[model samples]
Target chain A: MSGPATHVRGKKTLARSILGFVDKGLVNAVLVIVAIFWLVPTLGLFLSSLRTVGDSASSGWWTVFTTPAQLTIENYASLLSNPTITGSFWNTILIAVPTTVFVVIFGALAGYAFAWLKFPGRDWLLIVVIVLLAVPLQVALIPLARMFGTLGIFGSIFGVILFHVAFGLPFAIFLLRNFFTQIPAELLEAARIDGASDWRIFVQVILPLGGPAIASLAIFQFLWTWNDMLVALIFTNSGSQPLTVAIQSQLRQFGSNIDVLSAGAFLSMIVPLIVFFAFQRFFVQALLAGSQK
Target chain B: MTQLVAPVANSPAGGDKRRPPHGSSRRRMFMIALGFLAPALVFLGALVLYPIVYTVVRSFFSAGGGEFVGWDNYVTMFTNDSTFTAIRNNVLWVLVAPAACTILGLIFAVLLEKIKWATAFKLIIFMPMAISMLAAGVIFRGMFQENPNLGVVNAALVTVNSAFGQDAAYPGAAGRDGLGLVQDRGVIASESTVESGSEQNFPLVGIRVDSVPAAAAQAEPAVNARAGQLVGTVWLDVVRGGGGTSGQIDDGKTGLPGILVDAVAADGTIAASATTDAAGRYVIDGLAEGAYRVALPAANFDEGYQGVSWLSSTFITGVIILSYIWIWAGFSMVMISSGLSAIDRSLQEAARMDGANEWNVFTRITAPLLSPVLIVVFVTLIINVLKIFDLVYVIPPGSAKPAANVIAVEMWTVSFGGGNNQGLGSALAILLLILVLPSMIINIRRFREERQQ
Candidate 1:
């Protein structure tokens, strides 16, 4: 066990036991239990939404197994029929799409500069963006709310979109800049030596290469804007509130009306889930890259 | 002439035609970069940077934003109970939620190494990371309902308790007024001690007729007790349609079944005890020939497990933290798992070969090696929890909001949750920034260092 032969054996055994900090059986059991624990709440929400108000109020959701036929789509039907919720769904799309578009456009443009271009104060400017990433949105809420009101756009979807774009730029720029830097500098310089102007080089060179980062950033911004309640709550009027704010109103009013609340919650959740699952590889990759740094 | 002409073409200002002078070209590059960056910079300056500076300045102003009041809002914020509660709860969130998530994540990351269905399990755990805090709040709020019938948590607790432990037979049951039995501290005891060979009757009232067990039979009067024995009957004295004697069992009166009856001697020890039958009759067959009090212990009428009032002021903070951990633990796990995969496994193997057990290897080698990843996750979580608002706002009932308050939610409340005091709100916002700045700086430094490396 003291020589090169043992060292090789150690590597093989270590590969097997790298995860074996405890008994394998105990580890498996705990993992399964935790997985179940993580799953139960979301499962409850889905099952509870399908249950009638009376059925839901009388027994826990797991009891639905005893009488599975009682599950119905009425909650969802009613949720869709409600004018406020339906309108808010449209408002969410309205807010999210434009915000995503704007963040991507601006994030890509600035990210290109920070990545390939030489300028005075560039490093310091990048540092400012990093610091801005740390500032919580709370600091801006009061002043911006007042500013939006003075601009006569308060309580409108446009104002909410504007606010999101503003707050989202730091992170967008940060992520895009980092990702753009990874594009080989020689490629951009070669394009430049061929007489392509900076703008043409950005459009023809940087944007194509930065596609995955831009998509990831777009998905992140869209989901964030779609799921946002705080910004919409302050900036949008009732008429223009997104699904989050709209559902929040339902939560406050209905309290434990799981029938209505669960339907609304699942509705708000499903889009992000779809987007997330569709691009989860990129999403997780971006998260790992962004956070690890 | 060609040489002179060529010299002039390439000399001084002529170079500006083919390629700009160095200083001017540098300035031109700067202009182009500025043009590209201006939109984002403008938005950041106005929305992010300017608000930060404005908030700091506005903290000194009045609620109406008119009169200058130096340190008044800050003073009030520090002294106010709700603000203090918010600050204290923030400290708790900062302390507990991040560490819990990070630890749980590390566990999950390590555990996933040997598991067969690791990808599926990882997906299930990480699913919540995609969810909004608002939806997560709704999920948790429903999961922690106080009623066992509704709340899954309480239902499981109640089921486990009933299977292995005693639950109160009649929670919230009480005795009739002016009856021979007295209700004291949830116990219904005979007002007078009954000697052996005598009967004691407990005719309880106040239980709704519908709540009476369906299996309970009509009340039957207790039979005469033999010498050295005690007998008793416990029945629901109230009858439907309001036609029953106040302290006596009447027609259609149902028995309170499964209630424990205790006979305590003068020394306060239980001489004998029996459970009431379907007819509410209990016979303690071999009691000592001494006087004993026929009483129902508090357990008989105990309110049993109503589950936890998770939204109550006492537990709301914990509930919110639990939800935060639920949503965030996966993030930590994913990060730590990446780190785990990137580490050298032979070091752990060597340690194990040197007689270090699994736990020792994990603690000494694995954990110490993973510290960089762990610190990143921990600091990121610390920063995340400091500004947590959605679950705290949406999960707690309005009654428990003060207990669940953190600086972010407090700032919102003071400004727009009907307080209409943006000045104090700005003060709170600044305070939050102050609390969060150190973590931010650490993260930025780490980011810079990572970039350099």
Candidate 2:
């Protein structure tokens, strides 16, 4: 008893020392540096947008302390009020939120079948879906854009959303299917025996249980659409442009108002951060069966 | 793709085992599969399979129905030497950026998990990742704008140069005397890419430089005067061709080194100049070219951060690594976290009761069982990395010339960027697909395997 206890005690102390070092300095320092690394550029952008063209050229935003004190929030104020960027923000919302919703709903339904259904070619269908996930987005873009243009949806927000949903479905389905398989089959069989229809079974039995998968999938789709610059650029024009495209227009191959950009970027990010935090409980990707089986 | 059969409770060979379902159970399963999977299949075939097949067929025949080249594009990609360099560069990018970004992301994730403010810290690090590379490129391009000390990087360099490195000599000295030196302010439309950001600053032009006393410059006046001079301030625009030849400075056609005054400042506040002497050259004697600058009083070099607003480009030397890491790691972390959470807690408690420390519990008791998740994460992330474009597309190359464009970028540029050369773009893209598909297939197989387990 003494020998084992002492061995455990020694190991615990070693673990403690390692944890102590990490907690005391190394980890905190890394996190702080990483956070700052990302933050400074963003802040620089904010400062740049606010400063006059001359001031931006003459000095960095960080150097504002030594310079003539002429800081202003005009960049943000101006950009937020602009018709193009402002409108695009709404367009982005329309595209992102709906795409997220569609992908989750469809992916969950499809995943449920793949997990529980015993149909002809069930295994083949899943394999085909996985292979579909391998398709590069670029290879599909031009052709899809052409198809969309032909269908009269290319220039519209709907086209972009549809494209995102279509692409997002495969991976989303894959994730949900994987998650669905881990759930015990007895629960589903019990619900079925108790006379639940397929839809009822999905909604009452599986939906609540599938929160984490849905949330993460939603997060993925939302971010993809929100930050989507490529499809939007190709399919949509000036009026339908998203924040990324709008911001790209502001850059004059020579110099740009950085402060406005930083402020604008921050503004663009606000919703995602909120969504991420709001969904933090679901953020724990494996709370199924108490997360630990 | 290898077909993964159903997750039978036990191997069919091992007794009747948990017995594969029969009768009504089998029929209900077929109904479920048909109902749930059809929507996903239709979309996949329509969007993904159609285009890939189209590209493969289209690449074989040329734009105007040229004879089937049958691997000609692939041949050119490898044999055309320049294209090979591009492939090499692409390989370099794949090697450096993905690994660095993943490592950094994992490191940051692990580190940040400890902080009370971990969420806040993660937001900050991952924040850059969230910002479209397009925005990032622009911001960096501006900072790298090369007016001697005008660019942020140059300004920092100037501060450091003044603080550490020497201020350059005055502009009076003969040009091309031995070494021709001049300092001129550079311009950047994008932010400065801090590749070599930890640079010393050069002193502001017209200040310390003017004090070099024109007499030292006068030491070679006859020699300098004989050298061709810019009677008025001149702008030398380097175009794509005019591939330079080595020669002594000649008037008009050659040699800004041909001039006594290499350049008059754009503002005219400083007549600071370089003198080029006999071997047909003039050296701007005193100049601080240490940082935040494009030394236009010279040639062949522009600021490293010239972002291409044309066709949408930003030249960030560092952001490539930064962006790749954050995104990939963020995804990997989700997998890691979820995988760990999936393990039964009793096992953890059992280790605890047995006196296993947290480390031992995690490593010995945990990681072994977590192999499924690790495999899933590794395979998925690798697949994601293989076809990465959106993030790369956002970051325009940060140089006058990009170090290398991602295959996706190459595809877009080749296809629609003016030349209307769909064949080449399609070919490059097809090649990219060939490279990525095997791993992707392997990943799917693994995913199916884990699901079965």
Candidate 3:
């Protein structure tokens, strides 16, 4: 009986090892392939941006590796030299930053109220906000544009910012409300017993505790406003147009200027990539929180 | 300590002894809550609620919002061919793009589980999510360009084709008008019959100078034709500049190489066919001594692999949809991956221990558990794709824009993109709102379910 048991154990170990090896091999193979598939298009764009216009037009981007001397920063330089492109870059910053700051502040305040503070009609109001989450931005564009026009803020960065802030509130309020609800009610009560006013408790306790949620909200709002084209397209005139609108206009129909396109596209992509990587963990956590209640 | 004291502090006797009475305190708290909620509510009312109401109202008016039209714009929208096309394309988008993204994301997420570098893989895949839709549109537009030298996708396709010994014939080639060949549909055929042993000359035009192959030699008239053979020359009639005669092969003209020329019998059947060489010369040998029409088959004049015509009316929506998938698939993957990670590994193991195979374990355990997340992702994507505007607006060229329009884009076009019909645009906006509401309800319900769980 001992001899048969020993033989069985040896056979089981061999099978387990083989299984582990195959699993690892299959996982790695799939990971690598998917990674390549995701990376190649961006890789093509990046490599094309690095090459001169003539070189890019004459040969494939893959050929840049074979002829190392063909790479150039001329496209980037030329794009930077253009006044409109540079102006639109600043315009994007002007719109995104203010929108992010305002949305976070208002969203957090509203979220705190809905979570802890009790008021008449609070539940109904919260429900209203929740339903507003589904309102397609398209439904608002024409009416809002007309309103902005009447208000004389149309074709301005402020108009765009206002539109963004308004549209951004529902999601921000929803996310932060859910996040704020998880805070222990006891903590706020204790603060209340310590003679802190409601505002004091909110400012002193809730704000600090809500860092992750706020960061997530800020990142999301910033990215949306910065990368936005439709809002900026309708609201901002020629002077206040964001980088997205600028890049889009540069796309000529008859013959595309590839040099401007590749460089401008890279320029537009870089800032969001920076923000995404910088706060990637927070973003992921927010996504989980947002999706999983 | 705090827990024991907390209840006592919150007890009515203790709290009443230290604080204001319930009525005034409630009023003050309500005011404070009002203060906090006012800004968001005001913004929501002024921006969202008011606009929505106004859109519904204005939709009934005329283009300038001056006259009440009473559903006329809605009638116009539903009846308009372009608007119908937009609706059809949008339906296609909602059906295909989201499903493709969700499935790809699911595959990626599930496969990511056993990998050591899962974080890195997820980041790379999610990278496109950071790119603005405009940039993505640009990238895809360039990537799908018809010109091989310009578009990366076609460049790769051309390389693969050439590697496999298949090559494209001249795209955009045509028969010169008033020449011996008559152009019909896409085919260029002989206007008159030629007897065997006669040399027929076919002059082609409209091939771009740069598109002409480097191996193309100067046009040469067909050499002496044998008694049993038919011969022809297919050469570019136009010169680089503007000085060439219309129907004659002029000096400095180049041969339209690789053109397929055929000899047709009286019954329209192709009796013989020959492909042109570098000198634009083809000789159909072993033809019977009879009258035959020297013709260029439609395949010769048919547009060669111009790499998909991505910006054309036929494929513009597809190109835009591709771009959307590229940007959002990463987002779906990350969302679903987090859900996937929260799944119970013990359940999977238990199924495995019960002698379930990998596929069964996945199908029975993993998929059912992940269905909620999948539904949420799908619903969110549907909501998103329904209103997709930027890629559709930015990717297609001017000629194809009408074909690739979505409801959101058509709304903009009518209101702003030169249509200037505010009533129609408002009606379109309301229609979009109605369409998106169902998906939004589903998504909200899913969110509530997830929260309950």
Off by over 4 Å in 1: A1-22, A254-256, B1-21, B172-195, B199-224, B232-257, B264-271, B277-281, B286-293, B353-355
Scored on chain A only, each candidate's TM-score is: 0.91, 0.82, 0.94
Every model's DockQ: 0.47, 0.28, 0.43
- Judge candidate 3 against the unseen true structure and give its global Cα lDDT, from 0 to 1: 0.82
Ranking, lDDT, top scorer first = 1, 3, 2
Summing lDDT over every window of 10 consecutive residues in candidate 3 chain B, give the lowest-scoring window.
Answer: B12-21
Candidates sorted by DockQ, best first: 1, 3, 2
What TM-score do all the candidates reach, one by one?
0.88, 0.69, 0.81
Worst 10 residues of 2 chain A by lDDT: A284-293
- Predicted model with the maximum TM-score: 1
Cα DockQ of the candidate 1 complex: 0.47
- Select the stronger candidate by DockQ from 1 and 3: 1
lDDT of 3 by residue, B1-453 (tens): 011223333332111222332676767767888999999989999999999999999999999988998989999998999888888888999999999999989988888776778889889988888779888887787778787877877877767766775353566777777766777777787888999998888888777677677989988888899898998788888777678777666788888788788899989898998988888889999888789998787776554454557678888887788788778888889988988888977787767656566689778999999998898788778878888998988788878888888888888889998999999999998988898888767766765665456
Give lDDT for model 1: 0.83
Q: After superposition, how far is residue B243 of candidate 2 from its true place, in Å?
A: 51
On lDDT, the leading prediction is 1
Taking the tens digit of each residue's C-alpha lDDT, what string does model 2 give over B1-453? Answer: 012234444233211122256787667655665666667667767777787787787677664446677777767667754446446656765666555654454445444545678656644554444445555555555554555434555566556655653333233222121222333343111122111112111111222233332322211112321122222221121111444222212122222223233233334343344433322233333333322221333221222232223322233434454546644555555445555556787786777668776579767877788766555555555555656555555444334234445666666656754546566667777877787787667766765664566
Q: Candidate 3 — which residues are off by over 4 angstroms?
A: A1-27, B1-21, B166-306, B443-453
